[model samples]
Target: MNDLDIRCAAPSDIAAVLRFWREAAEGTSITDDHEGVARLISRDPEALLLAEQDGRITGTVIAGYDGWRCSAYRLAVHPDRRRQGIATALMDAAERRFLALGGRRIDAMVLESNERAHRTWGSAGYHREGHWRRWVKSVRP
Candidate 1:
């Protein structure tokens, strides 16, 4: 294993990222497509971070800071690459990004059924807030 390189995603990496998600990520999102990801990179170039080792992408995390709030999404690591500190590195990068942007706190979206993710997040010092429930509506125009 080589030193992992964490950097913001570029447009050229979209296809590879989508495919990586299908294999590594637990769930899908409305903005999983190329256009949607492109829009994200265009709007906030530093939001999507990719972890690469020896030129292959091993992990990813979306560290989005909308000036007021810091939101973490799509924290994924290749199945073959799990338990190898890839996720920890990604989270460390995301947290650093948030702190640099003056973000006081971070909210991560993890699936209820994803026990693996829960453990991962918890080990990273994140606690699930039972008081707040997420209410979402799929609004596709």
Candidate 2:
């Protein structure tokens, strides 16, 4: 394997990213389309991180920080590239971004059904918060 290039997503990369997610990511999101991703990069240029190896995107993670919280989402690696430190590298980069932004802690959004993600996050020192459950409503226009 070659050295991984971890970088922010550009506007031109949105289409490729959506395609990559379809193949590599475990699940889908309401904001997985081109417009949503473009909005993300437009709003916060550094929030979306991509892992590239030999000119192909192999992994990705969204590291978003509001004034009050640091949220991580969309952590995915290519099926063929699992257990190869790509996810770790992406998380490391996200953690560094949060730390630089004065973030005290990180909250990652991992799907409950993804047992593989559970182990992956657990090994990264994240534990499930048994007391709290997420509540959400889609405000689509």
Candidate 3:
């Protein structure tokens, strides 16, 4: 097992980042949502992070940090790389980056069907303070 190289993703890393997103998580909106990603990165570069090993992408997470609280969201580890502490490592960096940016609290919203995510977040020191059945109506034409 080659040691993984964890770092902040740049515009040059988009292809690898998108590849990981596709192969890592299929059902979730992470991979297929590249346009959204472009917008986010354009808005804030630190939102998307990647972990690579031997130059091969292994893990990824999407985070957003405003002036207020840090938002850790859309975490994913390549299918072949799951359970290797990749996700945790990514989260560690993310939290640190957020703190460095003067963020106060960290928050995330996990889907109710995603039990594995719930457990992962909990194990990663996150707790459920509340829940919401959010309603959204997209005005797509």
Candidate 4:
């Protein structure tokens, strides 16, 4: 396996990232569109982290810090590229970025049914918070 190149996503990478997520991610998000992603890159240039090898996107993770809380989203790895340490590399980069930004804690939003993701996150020392539940409301709709 070639060493994956891990870095922040640029505006030019938005389309490829959306395509990659459609193929690799478990589920879609409401804001997975080009405009949303572009807006994210525009707002926080280093929030979306990507892993590539041989010119193909292998994995991605959104490590967003709003100067207060650090949250991770869209942690996806290509189906064919799973178990090849790509996710780990992406997480490593994300953690480093968070630490550099003085983030004290990091939280990830993983689906309850995504056992693979649970295992991945567990291996990285993340535990599920049974005491807390997430509530959401779409402001756009």
Candidate 5:
């Protein structure tokens, strides 16, 4: 919508953001809970971006940078808001943030089973790295 407001997540917004993810996001992360998200906002402050329309969150994306790498996670849009350029607006904001921070490239994590997300990422100019596979070891149980 034309009234969409894109901004950083505030401490007050954690609860609503968690709820929004549960409703709009495709998959869950181990750190999807309150404490984890709170920690992120505390540490990076501006890494979590939200798109709101009339005070309700319509989409979200986490544009994280660890000094060297620019990574994107949790790019999600509300079901009712799909095909409305919300995701594109979010990515455009995220990429601008990364570029402003001197980031050369951004890597996005997309679920292999999520075909819709694959299409979305591809449309955003992200390509799969078929030569590499992700390896993960949870530091916390």
Candidate 6:
């Protein structure tokens, strides 16, 4: 297992986890959706798994299960930790959880421009589902 431990994230992990979400990769801080994260964890602790190695979260994935659609969202690995099997391990753990939750179909929405991420998910057995045009309307106007 590459000496990495996958486990459920606890309330105490909020700080370090947020840091990794914020500062890990350049231009990758688009993942700093903290309020969204808090809601997801509060709703489904099993959906948010942490990869701990030597006392640090090297990776994380927010797995969400809905009645009709189940998804693994915002799957991320610390920039320096990329290509180290961390992402794969995280996805495996999340998929297993999704299945246990009685999810039949799992989906991942990757930014089309991110070739590496596209390749990773593709190799991990997720194919191109379809193209989506995402229009985000800010709540605070």
Q: What is the C-alpha lDDT profile of model 2 across 5-68, one tens digit per residue?
A: 9999999999999999999998787898999999999999999999999889999999999967
Q: The CA-based lDDT of model 4 is what?
A: 0.93
lDDT of 2 at 107: 95
Residues 1-141, candidate 5, lDDT per residue (tens digit)?
Answer: 689899999999999999999999987888999999999999999999999999999999999999899999999999999999999999999999999999998989999999999999999899999998989866785
| Residue lDDT tens for model 4, 48-122 | 999999889999999999999899999999999999999988999999999999999999999999999999999
What TM-score would every model get versus the actual structure? 0.96, 0.97, 0.83, 0.96, 0.97, 0.84
Cα lDDT computed for each candidate against the true fold: 0.94, 0.94, 0.77, 0.93, 0.95, 0.78
* Model 2 lDDT, residue 6, Cα: 97
The global Cα lDDT (0 to 1) of model 1 is 0.94
Q: Write the per-residue lDDT of candidate 3 for residues 1-141, one digit (tens) a residue.
A: 348777777777776677776677635553255676677778888788888887888887777887887887768887777888998889988988887888878887677787888888899998887654556555543
Clashes of 2: 0
Cα lDDT, model 5, residue 33:
92
> Candidate 6: deviation at residue 135, Å?
4.6
On TM-score, the stronger of 3 and 5 is: 5
Locate the minimum summed-lDDT window of 10 residues in model 1: 132-141
Q: Which of 2 and 4 is ahead in TM-score?
A: 2
Q: Clashing pairs in model 2?
A: none
State residue 19's C-alpha deviation in candidate 5, in Å. Answer: 0.5
